[model samples]
Target: MAKNMTLLWCTGSCPCWRAMIALEEKNLQGYNHQLLSFDKMEHKSQQVLDINPRGQFPTFKHGDNVVNESYAICFYLESQFKSQGNKLIPDGPEEQALMYQRMFEGLTFYDKLGNVIYYDWYVPEGERHDSALKRNKDALVAELGLWEGYLSKQGSGSFLAGKTFSLADVVVFPTVAFLFRFGLSAGRYPKLEEYYALLKDRPSIKASRPPHWLEGPEEELLLKEI
Candidate 1:
């Protein structure tokens, strides 16, 4: 039986986007989500804070167990709903290791790019530092190179870890899609252009692509569309 589960989520945030993609990939159907509002500070209210004292969105509530971190929440969903569609991480050591390795590498890119993308785009002009932006962009460039190398070696045939579409694809593709479509795209990388184009065609991703909105009802609807 599917547990009575609900995700306290955020729209437009990369971390929340990750959870959405993970849920789709696993095909763990039927659970609803409560999309919280950052503008209204709903995440900090007593209702949400009671479940997640850290006041973070994309928090997962499964009966008594609560998961806060995006990555950990995905893991928890996969573990609890193991009988669902796709296995984000396989059971065998060798196979599971490959999934973890690519997924973790994807997280590294999230960290490197997040510093610039989140701060430069979101932070107030006065609060954002030029030096920090440059350094973070540089780090993202380096990480992109690493991804290019990995793709050239592995993402050629079907997926990142060779033949099977695993957690890595779910974790990496959305950011890649955003980067290419809106932001830098292919400022410094050639291999990524071809790779991302192919990945954007994935049905799960195409179905999950969020619509743009400012805040409140419109933004909440966009997230539910995913």
Candidate 2:
């Protein structure tokens, strides 16, 4: 089943990691995959452009069907191979609702984090303002608080959305890991810290971890204050 699929991805990209983790969770092995270098602008190469017009990392193809969006790729894989491996979608209604909520909320969470982390990269130096950067950082801190509260409410549940690891974790874990990788302090958000530690050793996460992350030191302490 895996032989028909191909993935073009970049290391350390949360979206790219999302697709990789999903594939591993589904136990879909032997898929053709290439690691592109973002530093070299390989994501813009003709190969990715052929599969994804936007030239994004995680240009995924299953047979002739292409799924470029990371979350959509996960959903599609689960729907297409429901019986093949671990069930990502929960069966209970409450858990399903929570899973869907967190899955979409993960987008907003990532956006807030990116706004702060990539502020200087995305904004021209002359156009950048300290106030704007502070606002973005404040937003990310609040967003982390919300997630911490959600996890606290989970009580004994180790996984997001429910007691079992579901699509919510698959979608959100990469972003959370990215934030920590960028040096979000572990002390301020203990629940998130614990969650990260817990998921770090999970088979899928371990197997699909960004290779570059293993080779170098963590990025700047961008969120150390918060």
lDDT of 2 by residue, 165-211 (tens): 99899999998898888887788888998899989989999999999
So what's the TM-score on candidate 2? 0.97
Question: Who wins the TM-score comparison?
Answer: 2
Q: List the residue pairs that clash in candidate 1.
A: none
Off by over 4 Å in 1: 1-3, 91-94, 120-128, 213-226
Candidate 1 lDDT by residue in tens digits, 32-51: 67777877888888878888
Q: Which residue pairs does candidate 2 place in steric collision?
A: none
Q: Which ten residues in a row have the lowest lDDT in candidate 2?
A: 217-226
The RMSD (Cα, Å) of candidate 2 is: 1.0
Over 4 Å off in model 2, which ranges? Answer: none
